[model samples]
Target: MKKAVILLSGGLDSTTCMGIAQNEGYELYPISFDYKQRHRKELEAAKKIAEYYNVKEHRIISLDNVGGSALTDKNIDVPEYKGDGEIPVTYVPARNILFLSYALGYAEVIGAEAIFIGVSSVDYSGYPDCRPEFIEAFQKVVDVGTAAGVKGKSIKIIAPLINLSKAETIKLGTKYGVPYHLTTSCYNGKEKACGVCDSCVLRLKGFAEAGIEDPIEYEK
Candidate 1:
């Protein structure tokens, strides 16, 4: 089986990516980051999702020094319900860059053929890092910088849900039997999801549009 490194965040999209990876018959090496984000509960959810998949490695790297966005710094407040066009305060600077960098290194070490990240351009939080152009640029970085790439074995960076809308993503995930209930999307970092936050709101909207009720609990 071909090996793939998946950046699993224990959120709706990332978990859906995990399902997609499995469906594609890859030996999953799921990686989660502990970047001092407000929603640390997602880490626990990541663990559960990894367990569900029975992956051999579920590496959780600590990135406590990486702070700037509201998600990472407690001093910053997580803004509620910003429209999709405006890049919100929650956009962690260079987060996807840092994440893909780590995944690229790990893929080289493990001889993995692909790296999967679940970043959607449509129905997203206006994070610039989640854009296709950024992913394309980072793919070039992997090709030029990695030993595997120099050896003519370039690891593919796959964003399977990049162009899909949130509802479309949910539909695909449902077809793959993604366990959405095990994931968390609230930026509020509480035990229950604050449904009003952008993440939660998008997730709810997706599930609603997909004609499936979200299994996770949300605060009233």
Candidate 2:
């Protein structure tokens, strides 16, 4: 079987990507980051999701805790959902860039054919990195920067949920039997989701729109 490295954050979207990639017949190599963020719940969720898929190896990369983002820094509190189009405080500086770089290196080493990220342009917080333009630019970087790319065999960077709305993504994941119960989308990182942070709010809205009950508990 072919191999694919999935950027699994143990959230709703990334877990969906696991289902999608598994359905696509790739041997899963899920990669996660342990960047000393405020919450450890997502990391724990990632591990559970990986085990659910029975992946041979799950890499949790330890990254130095970078400040400037509410998600990573304890000083910056995670804000409640604001539907304004402006990028939120939760936007981590150069997060996806750094993550995909590490994933690229891992894919090259493991000879994986694709890297899966579950970033949606629709129904999301206004993070610049979650947009299609960023994915396209990163794909260009992968196309030109990697040795495998120069050799005419580039690892594909797949964002299966880029164009889909949150509801649509939830529907897709449901079809693939993704274990949504094991996922986490609470930016606050508490065991019980705050249900107010942008992450939790979006997830709740998605499930509501999808006409499915969110399996996780919330501290509303």
Candidate 3:
């Protein structure tokens, strides 16, 4: 059986991608980051998703000290961009790179050849880390840095949602039987989702565009 590492964020996209991995019959290693985000509740969601899927292993690595962006800093504000003209304040600095690096390390340790992340460039909030170029660059890094790569084993960075729009992601999630109720995509750490944040807005739009009502409740 092929081993695969999935960057499970407990968000709709990641959970959907997890379904893809499971469907592929990959021995799953689901990894989530505890990166001091304001929405720590999402990590709890991640845990539930991991447990629900019965993955081979689940790891929650801490990135608390890697602070700077709005996600890591309590003082920083998450921006509500009506539309993207640039990267939103919610864009965590080097987030994808940091995530992939850790996933790479975990993959190496666990003898996995592929790492999956749920990054969408289309219909996105404009994070540079979500781009195909970034993933390609990181793939190069993975190929060169690992013992498996040096021994003719190539590491693949899988971004199943990279080219999909938010609506398309939602459609695929539905198609794959993803547990949307278990996913959370709010920027607030409160009891309910603040439906005004960029993430909440996008998620709401996704469900709407998919012609489906969201299972999760929001604090409008």
Candidate 4:
């Protein structure tokens, strides 16, 4: 069976990627990160989603918190949704970069053909790393930096949700029967999602647009 490494953040987007990858017939190897993030509940959510897929193995990587962003720094507060052009405080410093690097390494180790990340440019929280130029540049990095690339068998860095809006992503995931109930998108790390945070707001908005009820409880 063809294998793929999925970067599972236990959020809507990442869980959707899991569904897409499963639909594509790849043997799933989900990899989640524990970077001491403020929203650590997502880690537990990741476990549930992985189990829902019945993957061969779910790898959880524990990374040290690089404390510049609100996601990692306790001193900083998670702000409400701001659709402004500037990068938000929740943007983990080079988060996707670090995540992709780790996924690249794991992909090579497992002889996986591709790495799946669920990042969407549309309906996102103003994170610069989620943009196309960044993914393209990182593809270049993979092409030059990895043995797989040097051997001309480059591990493809795939972001299937790049062009899709959150509602579109939700619709697609629903088509694949993704267990959205198993995923969590709260940045507050509370048991009940803080509906006002950027992530929860985006999630709720997407479910609304998709004409789907958000399955999780929210502390509005």
Q: Best candidate, TM-score-wise?
A: 2
Encode model 1's per-residue lDDT on 35-130: one tens digit a residue.
878766999999999999999999999886577788988898988886849888888999989999999889888989999999999999989999
Best by lDDT: 2
Comparing 2 and 4 by TM-score, which wins? 2
Off by more than 4 A, model 4: none
Clashing pairs in 2: none
Residue-level lDDT tens digits of model 4 in 1-220: 9999999999999999999999999999999999999767899999999999999999999999889998999899889887877788888988999999999999999999999999889998889899888889999999999999999999998999999989999999999999999889988889899999888988999999999999999999
Q: Which stretches of candidate 2 lie over 4 Å from their true place?
A: none
lDDT of each: 0.91, 0.95, 0.86, 0.92
lDDT string for model 2 (148-218, tens) is: 99999999999999999999999999999999999999988776999999998899999999999999999
* Candidate 1 backbone collisions, by pair: none
Q: In order, how many clashes per candidate?
A: 0, 0, 0, 0
TM-score of each: 0.97, 0.99, 0.95, 0.98
Residue 163 alpha-carbon offset, candidate 2, angstroms: 0.6
What 10-residue stretch in candidate 4 is worst by lDDT? 80-89
Q: Of the pair 2 and 4, which is ahead by lDDT?
A: 2
